[model samples]
Target: MHHFFSMMFSLLAIIGHVSGQPAKGGSERNIDRPYRSELTVSNGMYWGSWGYKSMCPIGRYAAGFSLKVESPVGRDDDTALNGIRLHCIDRSTGSSDSYDYTTIESDVGSWGVWTDIKWCYSGYLTAFQLKVESSQGNGDDTAANNIKFTCTGGYYLQGDGTNWGKWGNWSPTCMGKGICGIKTRIEAPQGKGDDTTLNDVRMFCCD
Candidate 1:
């Protein structure tokens, strides 16, 4: 009778184990899903009188960034934009950090193309700073006026105090259609104070 009870207990344990096992297709259905997120654009500042604005609003949840350089129609031939960098947010820790990218300022009349996108090692991009030169408004004057970012989902909480570019005085309102883009107004070739020739323009997206 003792042996019989022991065998019955062992049989019951086997049945429980078999019943607890996953179904034939259960493992496939239980696989984890891939991560996904959306982009959020934030309007940066319009610093200085001739501050340039980005082509697209920098996404708050920026995965990467690019810079824009211009060679004004009637200004210096030597000066131009070189490169750009970014400040990223470590989403896991909610901390801010910086990433840099520089270019060779060798070409002449070469309106520098957008630099390759630089991704955050850990998180998304939040803010940006520029490398500019004001040759007292001299000839061949070049400076950076605009920047853009590639963004992902939930990068910035609304009013979470993420940094945007500088915001200068608002431009005159559009006559009929709403303002959807920006353009810089430079003090080109000015030979006195700062010759901020690469005046900046920005886009104004309406919510």
Candidate 2:
């Protein structure tokens, strides 16, 4: 009787293993489908921005801007931004498109500022402009502080790098149907006895 019971148990074990194979295969297929869906959603949008600031003056100073961008996670990971352009506006001259900075593709983390010291022939730059274009439809949105800078020349410089140059007294120049100008003031360096003066600086942007 014992020998008979052992043989029955072995036969039952074999049958159970055969039946479980199909269920395991089905579960694997189901698990793969949802993972692919999540990947698709994560790769939809691209994010980035340009942060600006002013530097000390030593006869000439080239300011720099920082950029942060995120590529799609998975689906269109191969897709890349074409490039970014930087421009400077001169309000005094009423001339737009003062300078053209470098261009680069989408990067993972925050990139250092695009300094005028490196690109400027001399350490001289009046204002800045920035614009970002991407291959994707819903490219990204920039932050307001994206264009912050120090008060060196007694005025604030703000504009789309073209159309509007610099302005003074914190007033609007290209007010109607044109690019809006940014207002600024020059802060007298510490320990220097001078009154705070406000002035208008030129605008700049990337293409």
Candidate 3:
């Protein structure tokens, strides 16, 4: 009888411990997403490099991102990259988690400042979209064209770009579940006639 009681106590203790801890696998991730600033420009038609502008190694959903453009001649609107927005949902329920922008730049010809990083409403960032344009005359110009998102269940949202290329369709699924983190790829800036473009964005899986 004593041994039976001890076993019951142990089981209860284990259950309590499990319940006190965070639930993994399909649950929300509690990781940090850091932002980085970068610039890329091209001098000729299509000559530049693509690398990370910002990255968060820990597993976290891509709530959203802020874009920064450099234009030697004009403002943010006159740059090649315009702005970006998010389209996401609750990871567990799959319900729409829409977000509204409050600090959008007014001028369409010049990117004033780095717009605020927009995030998801209910769940981790699960998907995204982009807005881009062709490089202006002969000026050192650059823009962040696309972005990605990671979820809890290994699911992801990804996209890419080409010189003056139009926006593509959103990715169906990164892995299978939710978003974790993101890495922004960029093109290096060149002298005048820079035609830089954000090539692609990749998502990282959580541990």
Q: Rate the local accuracy (lDDT) of all candidates.
A: 0.31, 0.23, 0.36
Better of 1 and 3 by TM-score: 3
Scored by lDDT, model 3 comes in at 0.36
lDDT of each residue in 147-168, candidate 1, tens digit only: 4332233232121111212423
Indicate whether candidate 1 or candidate 2 has the larger TM-score: 1
Poorest 10 consecutive residues of model 3 by lDDT? 101-110
Better of 1 and 2 by lDDT: 1
For model 2 the local lDDT of residue 156 reads: 40
lDDT by residue (1-207, candidate 2, tens digit) is: 113343355346435533543121122111111110000111112332222222111111122222222232333222112112222222333322334222211111121122222222222233333222223234322111123232234344332221111222221222111121111222211122211111112332211
Where is model 1 poorest over a 10-residue stretch in terms of lDDT? 101-110
The local lDDT score (0 to 100) that residue 41 gets in candidate 3 is 26
